[model samples]
Target: MAEIPANSLRFHVQRLPGHGAGPAVVFLHGLVVDNLSSFYCTLAVPVARAGHEAVLYDLRGHGRTERPRTGYDPGTAVRDLAALLAALRLDGHPVHLIGNSYGGTLALHAALARPDLVAGLVLIEPPLGGDWVANMIDTLSVAALGLEDGTLHSELTTLRRRKAARLAATADALLNRTSLIDDIAASRPFTPEDYGRLETPVLAVFGEHSELLPGARELARHAPHATVRILPGLGHDVLQGGTEALRHAVLERLGAVAAV
Candidate 1:
């Protein structure tokens, strides 16, 4: 795990250098309880093998990154990504961004903020509209309540579920002890108009059964040149379960972008 100073915080960054002169591909993981390991295990290696430098990092307050009290909003997250790219000296280069869930939201914002820096995008199951933050807060609050009631703890202990226990504990701390919920609630979401104006080539991949499929369809409908793919027999966890298909789609898009 490598650390770098970005956005006034130390970020956990990992880089896999590629063989040839291909574009740099950055992988952004989902929010809370997710880390670069997900991408590191799935797409990062394959991307590197495809002759593209693969960069993966833990977002603020996730994985091995510094867990600050505030600055968890999309705007701040976009800034952190920009700062990370600059710190890595990838500012002027047209890099491709592959973001999962909330990470996809940040990628969209980053491309909007600095189109010159982003060449293409791959968004997997990004929640675009609705009260996603509120829903997340409600879910976390319920989990925290369960933790306090000893229900979750007792179940985990009885089942010897070490991983589940650790993840639940982490989620409890992040939701109850920090300003993550507040920051997410206060953040602004992009409008349909915003999506329609994006000039960069975007590949939006969503599971056929995912609730966010509507949002993905909307993005494709609005965005000038966006491609949407629906993977069958999958759900919201497409990044984990549909790695082979996602990898193929991403590499295909990267190849298309490189050809242009």
Candidate 2:
């Protein structure tokens, strides 16, 4: 684990260096309360072992990355990613992106903004509509209130949960004290025209019961070269519950790209 200066902020980055040949694969995790640890533990090592350089980074205001009071919008997130990749000397190469949840939305935005820099995409249960932001804000607001009133702390302590309590505190600070919710609400959702214009290959994975299934279907309709996979008995947390399936889908996509 190391910190790299990108977009004038320090970003915690982890790299699993592979043989100098295969395409570089970068993992982008979900929104607040999430970090690079999930991908680092589940997919990064496997991808590196598969002969591809795997890179994982904590998004700004998440994990060990610097948390500024502002700049949590999708546009800023995209810029941060561009700067990070450039700082890592990955600007000249086409990289594969694997994004989970909100991270997937950022990946799509990045690919649309700069097609030459992205070779392919693997989006896991990506929420597309603008309503998601509103929903998230409401949910986080409730959680923050619970944390503030001691209800959440009491429950966690009663259950002997240390990590959960710590995470809850962190989430509360990020949601209630920062501009995260506002930034997300202010973000521009991609129009159908945007999706229709993408020529990059996309592999979209959705849980069978996920609310974002419509987004996956819409993506397939717009992106001509997209492949959609729905995992059975799963929901929004496909990255956690469907790890093996996600890994296989990612490897297969990478292999197909390499063969091309």
Candidate 3:
């Protein structure tokens, strides 16, 4: 992971240059539970192997990046992304954006805000409704505020107390950044009106068994250039088990988009 200074903050970014002359693909990880390393370990290798550059980064306060109390919101995140890409000299390049969950949301907002910077987008299960928005925020707030009766507290306590095992605890602590979650929950939902304006080609991948699949399908339906790829026997972590298959699927979609 390489730490780059941008937008008055520091972020940990992972970049893998591809063998070919294709445009680079930038990856964005899911919520507090996932980071750039997770994507690097799971997906970036395949992208790199496919002769495409892959870049992954940890959001503010998530991984090795410096965490700030404020400016974790979406607008700030979008600006931060623009600044980071500019710092990396990817601002005007036709770069592919791969966002998982919250990261996906960030990608959408970024693409909307900076269309010329995005060549294509791959969104993996972004929350689609107000209910999810509220619940996620509530959960994160409960944790950040250190509420004993909240889910975050209970989960963190379990993780720390060894009742949840050390690996699980590490995962929780690594993935669950209270500030990020709260920021999302406090944010608004993506209305249908939002999709009609998106010009980028989007590949929406969702787990067949994931609760968010229906929303993902709805999003694909609305996006004129969107398509859905469902991974059977998988939930939120669809890319976890059938990694090779997922990588092939992603490469295929990216290739198809490049052809068009």
Q: What is the lDDT of residue 252 in candidate 1?
A: 93
- Residue 90 CA error for candidate 1 (Å)? 1.2
Ranking by lDDT: 2, 1, 3
Q: In candidate 2, list every pair of residues with a backbone clash.
A: none
Quote model 1's TM-score: 0.93
True-vs-predicted CA distance for residue 16, candidate 2, Å: 0.2
At residue 66, what lDDT does model 3 achieve? 76
Cα lDDT tens digits, model 1, 189-259, are: 66889998897999999998998877787788899989999999999989988999999999999999999
Could you give candidate 2's per-residue lDDT for residues 1-260 as a string of tens digits?
89999999999999999885967999999987898999986788889989999999999899889988888888888899999999999989999999999899999988998888899999988887647667777876776676666678568878989888777767776787778888887877767788899878999999999988877878888887889999999999898899999899888899899889
TM-score of predicted structure 2: 0.94
Local lDDT at 202 for model 2? 92
On lDDT, the leading prediction is 2
The Cα error of candidate 3 at residue 72, in Å, is 1.4
Worst lDDT run of 10 residues, candidate 3, spans: 163-172
Best by TM-score: 2
